[model samples]
Target: MARPKILVVGAGFAGVECVRRLERELSASEAEIVLVTPFSYQLYLPLLPQVAAGVLTPQSVALSLRRSRRHRTRIIPGGAIGVDTAAKVCVIRDITGDTVAQRYDFLVLAPGSVTRTFDIPGLAEQGRGMKTLAEAVYIRDHVIAQLDLADASHDEAERASRLQFVVVGGGYAGTETAACLQRLTAGAVRRYPRLDPGEITWHLVDIAPRLMPELGERLGDVALGILRRRGIQVSLGVSVAEAGPEKVTLTDGRVLPCRTLIWTAGVAASPLVATLGTETARGRLVVRPDLTVPGVGGVFALGDAAAVPDLAKGGDAVCPPTAQHASRQGRRAAANVVAVLRGAPLRPYTHKDLGLVVDLGGKDAVSKPLGIELRGLPAQAVARGYHWSALRTNVAKIRVMTNWLLNAVAGDDFVRTGFLARRPATLRDAEFVDAYLTPEQVREHTASLRAGLDGPPTG
Candidate 1:
């Protein structure tokens, strides 16, 4: 008889961890591991701002799927557009835009998430995002290009508009992006003899009452002070009402002339979740404590795609879609998959958050590890240490560490590399936002798959 095929969708932290665990735990005769994802690398999302600010190269954060300890995984360069639970088949749209169906005895859904955007006028077109590596690269180039144009211009009005930068969402991503990029521009202006350092302005806004409230009020204030101290206009309880080509209108009737608008507001679960036709809470699949999908046999879901119950918190509390939780869930889910195969007992998934860490660029940072507050160089060490230790490969760690040391000494050259071919500046182009299929399309594909294969296979 053929070995059981385990198909895992997504190559995010959760999916990658699941694959690594499965490879480590399962033997060659036990099962075949298949991973479907659009990208070949697992993006280390926490330090993405450092990539944007030139503190770290984009390659350092991208962990290759093929370079694991054991080469057991079969990687498909595709995105899972839909899952047919009854058929035990997943419809994947590959990088080339062709759809294919693969049957699996067990399925793991970890499609991850996309940038959460609003219907504000001109937001999608005029605004930029920091979600993908391409976005980070593009944002870096765009920021530098703006400085170049601003410095070259004799037009005071154009220079003023070009020098202004606006970042929406006061959460960790936005706060860090603003702080790091603010520092980047602040330092880069010293190279421009024609431009005054004070001419560069950065505005950070969020609908929340406080910046990084998850860090608690004390650390939030500490973060706020750091940004304000750096001359970044930190606005709370306000957001962008509209984004334009030349400026943004604030919800509180304030207009800021800016050429750059970065939207790091939040993330919504991948649209693939909707194609599963399952119970979902807040746009994520609702899974049991053991990370199994209810009413779906041999199916498990985790990460940003699944609302895995937080047994530690109890009472309908699903785990937050964070990398820390996702990594743990991946391991537990893999073990559960094995238990299912061997007719053994399964384990429940539960973990309390250790704490939060916010890197505020340079030697500044704020962390609440194990509920103990820390700041400055000490917090910076903790934050960087956690990230370095979490990296899966030695090369990634070495590159990141070397980049940090080199950047601290030499600083950013502020040179736009223009590494990405064609230079995709929009979020949809970079993120493949419209790639997922509808339920009906999925059903149609399932019908075609059944006819072609003469119904689902029995292994």
Candidate 2:
């Protein structure tokens, strides 16, 4: 008899964890595992800001999948374009544009998320994103290029626009991005004798009344103070009303001239969740406490794409989309999969919140570990230690630590790769806006595929 095939979509923290556990528990004769993802590595998202600041090399965060000891699992370098539940077939488009129909006895959906964007004019065309490794590197090179351009420009207004930088959203991503890249520019300015340190400005804007509201009231204030002390303009309760090639108009009726706009507002669940044709809460697929889809047999979802009920919190409370929750939920989802296969009782996922950490670059930071609020060097140490401990492999931990040490001793090398200099690295570009199917289209395509499999084409 052939082994049962288990297919997992995505290679993020959730999907990768699921695959690793399955590979460890199940024998090759019992089941065959397959992982589908566009990239060959699992990106360490939290350290992305450091990449933008050139503190860590890009390769440091992109942990390779080939390094895994689980040789039984077959890897497919592709993205799932559509899923037909009735046929139990997943349509995948590989990097080479070749399409394949993969059949599976069990399916795991963990396609992560894309940057949440609004309908603000010129935002999509002019704004840069920070979701992927490519985007981080692009932004770094782009920032350095701006500095080089500003030094050469004769017009004061043009130079001023080039020197100004704006980052939207005050969450972890936006806050760290502003803090790290601001430090990058602060140091890079000395290389350009013509550019004054005061000429370079960083503006952090968010619609929320406070920065990093998730960090709670006191720590949020602490983070705000650190950014303010670093000469960063923190604009709360306001957002960009409009964006142009060289200027952005704020909702508070202030127009600022700036060439760089890094948008980290938020993230929406991947469109793949909508393609599942299941019920959703706030754009995330609704999953049961065991991380399985309610009505879809043999299908499970987790991570940022699923609204898994937080059983620990009790009563309709869903888990927040964070790395800590995602990684834990991934393990739970895999265990439940094995339990179902063996007719064992399934366990519900329940985990308490593990506080939060924010590194504002340099010696300033804020964190609440085990319910204790900390700031300054102590907080920075805690933040780095937490991240270091959370890394999956020792190699990654060593590389990250080495990078930190080297950066501390020998300053940044403001070198530009110039990869994205000619092309626009907008949010849509990074997220592959055209890759997904709409909800209605998914239903229609699934129906058509099922019909085709049942009979011959009528036309």
Candidate 3:
């Protein structure tokens, strides 16, 4: 029998888990598995705020897929541009600006997601996204820089603008970013004796009624209470209708001038999901209970990219795109694929909500696990322990824990790395966008500017 060719797109939680399972279930010569992504590392996105707050290093959250012991699978460093379902081929664009079409017998669409953006004026051009390691580093440096600028400025308006930080969306991402940064800023201000922590303002806005909608009512309220105690302005049923370089206009008819806007509204499935030419629910490919597309013979999908039924709810509802669901589904997708090869029965996808955890910096948290509610120090311990165990590598776990220990004993390193100027800090200008041109183009422009500024024809 000919060996089957399996192609998995993405290196996030789903793709990485699926690849590991495939390698374990199949023999070296039995099948060929290919993992395609823009980078060879899997990003632990949940701990991104810790990176931004200097509680963890950016590299600590990145796990290199190529270094794993799963030797049977080939790691392709590239992004899958377009999929030709009819031809069973994927158009891949690698890091070196080369494009190639590869064929597969079986395909797994798990490109994960991207930040969901809207048509709000100036948002696309001016807003910064907090989805990557670069963004986390930039935020860390930028926040410290803002404090320095504010302290040095004689103009009260400029100082006030520099100290104000606005965050959109009250979900896990936004809430965590705001809380962590607020704590960091408080610590950062002590170093700058000229600046006062009370002068800084952090605004968190959301259209939802609560801080964390996924964490249930009781826990959400507790989370909100914690933020309020920390002096974070938690505004519900509100949104930024317009965002400018200097300020944002809220839907409530309030205009706030601020230098920083950390956008974390939510995420949508990858644009590649739309190009798959399959039946999808809100951009997520619809899948059977066994996690396979009904009509596509050798196609399977899970994670944020697939709309798998939630049998645990006993209703016609789809499972949410959470890390909890994605991790389990990735394993199930691999099991079903292995079942097909070995002539065994496939199992349906189902899981009960294990509860939620919201870390509100400085030992304050809210959690509900197994239907039991927890708050304060207990919840904070549980939240940190959960994330530590969920990390992919022991090295990462140690590094993250070490940073936390050092931070508690000493304090945040307020010094900026000055790396922001060397690269594009915004999402649109970064390589995350599908615009043509390479990193070389970015470097060349910098060189041209330097040449022009050094006077005409130096003898």
Best by TM-score: 1
Lowest summed lDDT over 10 consecutive residues: which window, candidate 1? 450-459
lDDT by residue for model 1 over 143-244, one digit each (tens)?
A: 988899998999998898899999998888999999999989998998899998888999999999989888999999999999999999988899889888
Per residue, candidate 2 scores C-alpha lDDT tens digits across 16-41 of 88988898888888888999999988
- Candidate 2 stretches greater than 4 Å from native: 439-459
lDDT of 3: 0.81
Candidates 1 and 3 compared: the better one by TM-score is 1
Q: Against the hidden reference, what TM-scores do the models get?
A: 0.97, 0.97, 0.92
Candidate-wise lDDT, in order? 0.89, 0.89, 0.81
Steric clash pairs (candidate 3): none
TM-score between candidate 3 and the true structure:
0.92
**Candidate 2: deviation at residue 60, Å?**
0.4
Ranking of all predicted structures according to lDDT, beginning with the best and ending with the worst: 1, 2, 3
Model 2 clash pairs are: none
Between prediction 1 and prediction 2, the one with superior lDDT is 1
